[model samples]
Target: MILVTGATGSIGRPLVRRLRRDGTAVRALVRDEAKGRALGCEFVVGDFDDPASIVAALAGVDRLLLNGAGALPADGEQPMVRQQKTIIDAALDAGVERVVKVSVWHAAEGGRLAEGAHWEIERHLKASGLSWSILQPNGFMQNFITGQGSFTADGNLVGAYGDGAVSYIDCADIAACAATLLTGPPRDGETFLLSGPQALTHTQIAEKLSAALGRTVHYVSLTADDMAAALISQGLAPRFADDVAVLTQGLASGIAAPTTTAVRDLTGRAPRTFDEFLAAHHEALAALAWAPSR
Candidate 1:
């Protein structure tokens, strides 16, 4: 049996569905009973902070998908480091055969936010003596719809990316890759960098959004300092805001513009393009309250 953490999240939701569709035995670890039931699969109420619940969820599970929330402003060190490390240790003790982890692209030592946190967890997972594969995905296309730190209060897309393009992959494709790794032969000690089929600038992204939503959605490019100040004004911690600005500013150099074939090589199909992603989520896009940038 496979146990999926963060089953209600962008990747986990599709992963669980794909596994179930293929008639694989899967269990979801959820924090809420209602959410668990909504998944329509075997689920156990569990929280990363609650070790006993996690232990209970691991029973009879051979494969594990390790994923959870990202860094928060209130965090001193990313909580995911402690939480995921605990799960790795427990999964080892539970006799789990393999684990698949979701990590961010550009994860390295001393990096900011999710990058640094994921690096720490990746090290822990590797040393646990358990078979593992890590998926280092670039930006998610879902961010445009969910506003994952990409939109202002008035729904304008705001960043310090200048004119650099990012090869943002769809979360569904990430889920498909995870499903393949979990259900197929173990890919121990391998890390895959996943991306969309093409790179796109924020200006191009805004154009796509305008066509899809039938309204002009603007991309506001600001300098690192101005972006940090805007985040501070929005009540984010100055340190956290500054880190975000620095990270986004790094994108201006086209660091994340590269695309990868890992998605196709794993799933035997090409990753979705930005236009495809926008079309698939048209209803969600229509529901968003984006206004024209002033």
Candidate 2:
């Protein structure tokens, strides 16, 4: 049996569906029964914060997908560092044979935000004596639909990325890779760097949104300080918001511009382009276009 954490999330939802469609025995680790039922699969109520719950959820499960929420605005270490490490320890004790973890690009020591958090978890997972593969993906294309750190109060695309482009992989593609790793021959101890087929600037992304949403979506470029101040006004912790802005500024240097063939190599198909992502998520984009911006 395979256990999928973060089953309700963008990547996990698709992974569960694909596994079930392929007739694999899969169970989702959800925080509540309602969410478990909503997933329409075998599931257990569990939280990463609760060690007993995680141990129970790992019963009879051989392979696991280690995924969850990202960095939060809390002070000190990111909660995911602790949460995922706990899961790793439990997975080890539970005798799970393999794990596929979702990590972020540029995960390294002392890196800001998710980078540092994922680095810590990666280290723990590597030393846990469990067979593991890590997926280090670029920005998610779903960020546009969810408006996560990508939109302003007026619904305009806002960022510190000037003209540099980001290769935002679709979550569905990431899920496909996970499905392959979970069900196919093990590529243990391998780290895959995933990205979309092409890199796109936020300005180009806004134009695509304009075409898809049938509205004139604009790109509002800001310096790191300006973006940090705006995020602080939204009630984010000053330190957290400033860190986010600093990370965004790094994107301006084209650090995340390169595209990779990892997705295609794993899934046996090319990753979706930005246009295809927009098309696949048409209804969500429509809703986003009409929703109140924050």
Candidate 3:
């Protein structure tokens, strides 16, 4: 059986659906029974913080997708790092054959908390003695629709990314690649960089959204400090908010700007373009009532 962690997330939900449709025996490791049941998969209730739960979740699973959430405390032990170690240990104990881990771009750079944790996990996965494939994807296109680091006021996209271009892939593309890696021939010790077909700046993204929605949209840049304060006001911790603001500055400087063909190579189709993504999510974008400037 194939097991998927973070099954309720953007990538996992679509991945589960695709796997089931393809007739794969799938089990979802979820923290909540209701969400698990809603997924229509064999459910295992487990919290990553608890090693025993991870062990329980690995029972009868042959292949695993390890997609973890992004938040981790800076001043304390990294929960995700511990969870990854626990999961790998349990998968080894259970004799699971293959594992696919989702990591972010530049995970090895060792600055961002999330990327740093993923770097450690990648190292552990390499030494775990299982057939493993690591996917290092760029930022998700869905972040724009979900109101992550920025938003639109009237018809303008506001963010700290000044003019740097990003090759952001759709989350569905990431999920598709995960499904392929799990079911295809053993890609032991392989790493794939999944990115969109084209690189685009925040201004370019705004223009695409405008074209898709048939309305003019602008990109408004903000200073890192201003962006940090804005994120903090939205309820994120001060340190995390500041870190993210700094990360945006890094992105603006073109540190995360690169296109790749891995998504198309794995999924047998071109990665979704920004225009395609905007078209697919047009309704949601239209529904958002932009908050007025404070």
**Candidate-wise lDDT, in order:** 0.89, 0.90, 0.85
| Candidate 3 residue-wise lDDT, 1-294, digit = tens | 999998998799999999999999999999999999999989899999888888888989999999877754544345788888889889999999999999988897476757888999999989889889999999888777664556644647777888898898999999999999999988888999989998899888887877776777788799989998877776666777787888888888887788988998999999888888877887876666243332
lDDT of 2 by residue, 113-230 (tens): 7898899999999999999999999989987786356677777888898998999999999999999999999999999999999999989999999998889999999999999898
Decoy 2 TM-score against native: 0.96
Model 2 residue 231 CA deviation in Å: 2.0
Order the numbered candidates by TM-score, best leading: 2, 1, 3
Q: Candidate 1: where is the Cα deviation over 4 Å? A: 73-77, 235-238, 291-294
What is candidate 3's TM-score against the reference?
0.92
The collision pairs in model 1 are: none
* Superior candidate under TM-score, 1 versus 3: 1
lDDT of 1 by residue, 167-229 (tens): 999999999999999999878899999999999999998888888877777999999999989
